[model samples]
Target: MSPKYDDVRNSLLGWLSTGLREEPSTAAIFHQLCHRLVDYGFCLSRSTLHLRVHHPQWLGTRIIWVRDQPHADEQTVAYDVEATDVFQRSPFHRVIHTGKQVRQRILIFGPHIFQIYEELREQGHTDYSAWPLDHSQGRRHLITFATDRSEGFYDDEIALISDILPLFSLVTEIRLKNQLARTLLQTYVGPHASEQILDGATTRGSGVTVSAAVMMCDLRNFTQMAARRPRDEVIAILNDYFDLIAEPIERHGGEILKFIGDGLLSVFPLDRPDACDRLMAAVTEAYDALARRSPLDHQIRFGTGVHVGEVMYGNVGSTRRLDFTVIGPAVNLASRLEGMTKTLQRPVLISGDFVKAANCASRTEYLGNHGIPGFDDLMEVYALRIDAELHAR
Candidate 1:
């Protein structure tokens, strides 16, 4: 390589090394790298980085950088995107699936060329090339470059980019893996629990005892709905129900620990003075939302049980498969109360402990102490007054 080219390569390598140490996001790295290449006299008008990620809702993401733009644009690709004809005919699909580079000059395109090539030609781009970006464990992604210059990229420019791609891939993979870890953790577990696990709290039985308002929510008649409806329809109904119930809990600063089939377990840790009050607010909002959906063809109905007590919150289960959750008499009491909602014909049941902690005795209707399974003594329970006038308070 010429001296000038060698200097450019070294400078770009140093920048990539600094980016790795700084841990900037993948999009930032792509934007800076594209600008740096342009500054180094490369005929680059646009660049894109396509990365497949491990996510429950998305298949991958595309980061697009245009010359003179202040920032790159990131677009998520859904799981079913690959099945489309546009994807199958694009250069990205060829490069990703074949693990090979695709170089085409727009001026000499054939009739059977992909629609993207035709679009690029219309947009004044003269050349386009895509290459597989290989990462660890044989994972392959994609990188593409396009130029509007009539002469396209010089051979030396392409060679230099090829030489530096390994370093770029290494830096990006680290950030992508870290991002994937956080995404998956937050998806399966709640954000609070995910943060704890990420901050070196992974050992089995490693946890802390915390005073919290525990809430358990279960969908009413879910078994009958699932058995009667189509599998896909049942899943859709469940998702809709969860969205309605989980939003209020999360908005009130509660962390949902588990989604057990047709139910969920959550807690509002008493770190703040109004923890129990917040739990009540969440319960009220959830009930109201469910009520609003009564006019729908398939309305969703659920029961919620609330209590306040100290519980152990942390990892528990088999050595290989540990679960980060809460467990104690408090959680059991909450579960039992949820079950009692069916017999009591109430949508919400609050234990006496929760009512006392929340300081809302005047707003609740006291139900006499009732016999609870597995407990020697009867537990006092209360029901929220669902009247609009009282709930307005």
Candidate 2:
């Protein structure tokens, strides 16, 4: 390689090493790398990076960079993307599965070789090449480069890119691992709890007492539904039910701390002035959404109990396996109230404290004070008047 090419390679290596230490955004780093290569006189017209991420809703992510574009474009690959005909017929599949490089001179390949080559040829690209980006534990990703220049890439240019790939892979692995950690945390625990764990709140039994509106929701007849139905069908039903209930709660700023079988526990922190209002709106929206669903085999029914009080919120469990969740009488009360929904024949039951905090007395029907287990005095309970409009204040 000439001095100019050596200079370019060194500069890129320095940048990537800094990126590994700084942990910059993956998209920004990739976009900068592509532009730098172009500025160094490599005839690069387009480049793409494909990453297979460990996520619940997505299979992978694709970052596309076009020459002269100010920023790169990013798109998430869905879980079913691998099964699509387009992916099955593309060169990416070969590189990803075989852990090998693919080089195609677009002008020489017939249309039947690969659909991607045909597309590149139509876009005036003369050459296409894909390389397997290997990471730790035998995982493989993909990177591709295309050039519109008549001569395509020189032998030395390709050699330089090949030599620098290990450095690029090292930088990317660090970022991707961090991203995967966050994704797993957020998936298993709520975002707020995940942030707390990430911020070094992992000690067992460590917690804080905070005032908030808490809710417990359970699907009715779920045990019986699971008993008779096929396991796959039962799981599908549970997912659908959770989606319907979980979306509104998340949209209204409630954090779901746990999904216990067919039920979930959520909270709206009182730090926000509208916490109680948001809880009410979220429950109402969830109920209305579930009511609209018309399942073929059975009807969907659920019970919700809401209360406002102080609870211990943090990590708890054995020394080895700790769980970040809420505890104390307030959470217990919410659970008991949810159980009462079946006896009272009400879809939603609210404690008196929640009604006062939300200022929704006019919209609630007073159910006389009732004796609560583990408490001395009778507790006042109210049922939300479903006919009344409930929305965020």
lDDT of each: 0.87, 0.86
Cα RMSD of predicted structure 2: 2.9
Summing lDDT over every window of 10 consecutive residues in candidate 1, give the lowest-scoring window: 384-393
**How much is the lDDT of residue 217 in candidate 1?**
89
TM-score of each: 0.89, 0.95
User: Any idea what lDDT model 2 has?
Assistant: 0.86
Where does candidate 2 have its weakest 10-residue lDDT segment?
384-393
Clashes of 2: 0
Q: What are the per-residue Cα lDDT tens digits for candidate 2 across 220-284?
A: 88888899999999898888878878999899999999999999999999997699999988888
lDDT of 1 at 195: 97
lDDT of 1 by residue, 86-195 (tens): 99888878998899889988875565378888888887888898988899998999999999999887787788888899999998899889988999999998899999
lDDT of 2 at 288: 73
Number of backbone collisions per candidate, in order? 0, 0
